[model samples]
Target: MKGNTLQPMTMPFRVGNVAPDPEREHAAPVRIPIGPEATLLKEPLLGRYASTRRDIDLDMDAMRAARSRGELPPFGGPWFGGMEKDVAWVNTTRVIGDASDAEELTRAEVTGRKDSVVMLDALREHSPAFKDGRLLHTSTQIGVRETRCLLGAYTLTGDDIRTQARFDDGIAVGCWPIDVRPAGDVGVHAMYVPLPYEIPYRSLLPRKTDNLLVAGRCISVDREALGSARVGATCAATGRAAGVAAALAATGGKQPRQLDAGQLRTAVRAQGGRVTPPAH
Candidate 1:
């Protein structure tokens, strides 16, 4: 995070509540029911699984008023509604800003909270299901999608992902596509990856920072590559590898960069991580 910074992108301030349409009577239960029916203004839902509303018209005039008053950002598409175990759920919120800076991060947090109110209001006023629904929770902080990236021993690139490159030091695997929520763009652009790719241990070793090992979305990767690696599963895998590598390094009195890649890979694989490429 110290060497260089990745370009900022839109991050959501997600909201969740007990299922507004518990019966799934109006909401489509399928993974992502796409079309004009699912959107507020009949504008095809922008992002993936954009919203849960189906065959319902929301108040467009009211949404316009909120936008004019600067209460909402350009993008406020909903994206989560389903059952989580016994509890039903709904998430309809969006707030976008460059959160790499401390001040900007704070601003995003405030704006996200405000946007949540506007989105919830829109839902309650138009959707009968949400009108009587109980509020479960809202995220306390803005989801920081990308920030400063480490310039490390190796920087993963889009080419590596496309080619399904393997590394002797591989400690984790990633399968998400290149998902980019452009600044102020309502829809996201994504490029599917052909196969799962290896994430090397070198990517976690920050240059000139022997005592530290970076992981998650902030690990060494190009902008195009970051788009793919920034998802939750990939981030979790990288974090796991970093944790294992750190423990091994500390015990051996070695810096992260100096630890043997083979030993690290073995340790990671032992933890049930996919370190080697699948057998052909």
Candidate 2:
């Protein structure tokens, strides 16, 4: 996230077949009905599914974050339990939505609370990493350090990685790198950034529906770029832009991608989205 301007959207991903992201080559799987897999999911949905919604009992916090591994959804954070030096269980409810300084809180983190469960994200993106029972001084801004992506229109492979790809319908831009944590996950196999790539509008389109627009990792990018394109902040910006694009088409009586580039970008900006060229 260094050198990149941070822009995050505050919208939740719509729900449907938003399976999750990355690892290996995708054959551009089409959208299919839940087949009992999407039901009872708690992980945040993204991409095309981000454009739809489903109701569930979100009152249960742990259930709110649960997801089965049927489709291998793209999600991260410390793996819970099982080892020493594990930084997965940092407690966050203590400071969410409040303007509190993390450094100060981390400086006095209490790991001796037997009644509380906590995690220490030491890389300094979310919670400070605890070292020697002392928290490491890190950015309190809480950033997403790992990257993973869903399947997409373009097939980005390891051989084709380390370079950027320009798509016919570039809807989003990427400058972030691909980083994975705790040795292995589905998508991350490296500790560096791959060449930035453009996200295609088709990538954002759900395979079967004409009315949905996926934002975030749910949108399409190959297993490689998933790590970069699926950044939460950027995904939010993309979601905002997609929402405006959908709105303009809905209000002015048009198709999802039927608007003029300038008009669409302008509408997105007017709706509080940030876009650069081709419409700047």
Candidate 3:
């Protein structure tokens, strides 16, 4: 939701395991499509609209073929049937894999819109899809949730994870999973939860850089904290904080850490950001 209008691309993998939908007992295997590039994974998505067209064509081919031959929800059978445990992961993968193309169509339909590459050595990883490449639908360019921290005056550390640190410089509040999209477009790193949290100004700081502030997945956080702050709602708040801090620093000729704490808190409060009262 970074408001990126990145175009979608569909590049299918070499192998596929269609979960035979018992209902469609007359159809053949449905080939699942590949995912888009993370670099290109932006909102207001543009460019790769053709990928959706190709996918629909292929999926139609698959559905027709499956129906002509007879297939059903899962075309494979027993294995896919008992895969309920992995449902969450599979469903999430569909974001960049299957539904992304479909979702892009919504851009043309509702907002209206547009599309991944396949992978080679996935089974080696401890991914849930590891059963001899049985149920996994990994991609070519692994999903990358974020990049550089943008470098700020203070860098957030791992310990700040669940402790719920506060700052007069704090500018946003967010709570989500430590969701890390994988390197190849399919696999991702995520932790389940943590308390509702506020992104510290430190998270905006790069190791040794200054001025620029970073928010979203690029924030400094622990493996767990990253998961918690990765959600869109959370990132948005973090972004809002960065924007305010940057503006203040640029206009006042003050560093982020040097800004008047009282003034910073007042500004953030004005924006509906929730902060804890000072601890005497």
Write one digit per residue (lDDT tens) for candidate 3, span 132-187: 33434433333334333344455554345455666656666654434433323221
Model 1 scores a TM of: 0.74
Residue 16, candidate 1: alpha-carbon lDDT: 41
Cα lDDT tens digits for candidate 2, 110-164: 2212112222212122222222233323233333322333344444443333545
lDDT for each residue of candidate 1 in 69-128, tens digit (9 for 90 to 100)? 776555544444443422334343444455766787787777766666666666667555
Q: Which candidate comes out best when scored by lDDT?
A: 1
Model 2, residue 62: C-alpha shift (Å)? 32
Better-scoring candidate (lDDT), 2 or 3:
3
- How many clashing residue pairs are found in candidate 3? 53
Each candidate's root-mean-square deviation in Å? 5.9, 18.4, 15.4
Each model's lDDT comes to 0.65, 0.39, 0.42
The better-scoring model by lDDT among 1 and 2 is 1
